[model samples]
Target: MRSVAITGTRATGHRPPDEYGAIFSAYLRPFADGHFYIGGAKGIDSLALLWLAGNSAAHLTVVVPGTVLHQPTEAQQAIARTRERIQDVVELGAAELDTPAYHARNRWMVDHASMTIGFPHADEPEGGTWQTLNYTAEQGKPRLIVPV
Candidate 1:
């Protein structure tokens, strides 16, 4: 099956659990039949990785913003477990933690997938989720937005 990239807000305090579950099962599962592309971050990126973990046929590529295990956090450590469980994981390191490089990572994710799913928060324009969505739209790729 074709590959798809998943993107969304990191700060997801407003998202209801049921809503995320429905979004994952309904919007994420079909694309995750085989190889799937996910940026290495929290919230929806991590959630998609978690769901895709159960699908043995699925391959996951986690395009990261910095060096592998570069900016490790508690959440990222948890994601590292899921990453280890997956068949594949791709790390695209940024030279530094600059806005340009971070946005570049998002663009790279868009270029690799024909489809993207984004959960956008109204407040953050420079956020990775919004940036990824915008990049996908600019490329005219199919995109789904889960509103905040």
Candidate 2:
């Protein structure tokens, strides 16, 4: 199965706001059968996880900087409840959870996927999302940006 990596900003909240939800839903509709790889972070990552749990038939793999317990409470709960639906949960070694850990996780996702979907702020234009998309470009992977 093809895999699509999801990378985005952490500013969207646990549940995406209305506008973001619309964009996210639209962007994900075509990937119903694709495997989703996401960093188990607080904002966009958790929002994507919840969206997939409710809308898509795709398998999900959450790549974490540390243990699942290290994720935001909302993400942890969602993963626990939907454990059966998820295909895999990858936890990085403890030493990898520092400032650069999120970048590492992003690279892991990008390396494993065929394409990447990103939600980035055009104004701010910098963060993990930007870094991941840059990596995706360097790897010559296709990218779909959902402007937020």
Off by over 4 Å in 2: 13-16
**Candidate 1 per-residue lDDT over residues 1-148, each given as its tens digit:** 7878777777766777667777678777777665777767776677667777754457778777886576447347647678577665566667786778768878887898888888776577656777778788889988988665
Among residues 3 or more apart in sequence or in different chains, the pairs in candidate 2 whose N, CA or C atoms overlap within 3 Å are: none
- What residue pairs clash in candidate 1, if any at all? none
Determine which window of 10 residues in candidate 2 has minimal summed lDDT. 12-21
For each candidate in turn, the TM-score is 0.83, 0.90
lDDT of each model, Cα atoms only?
A: 0.73, 0.84
Off by over 4 Å in 1: 16-18, 122-126
For 66-92, candidate 2 gives per-residue lDDT tens digits of 889887887788788778888899998
Rate residue 69 of model 2 by lDDT.
83
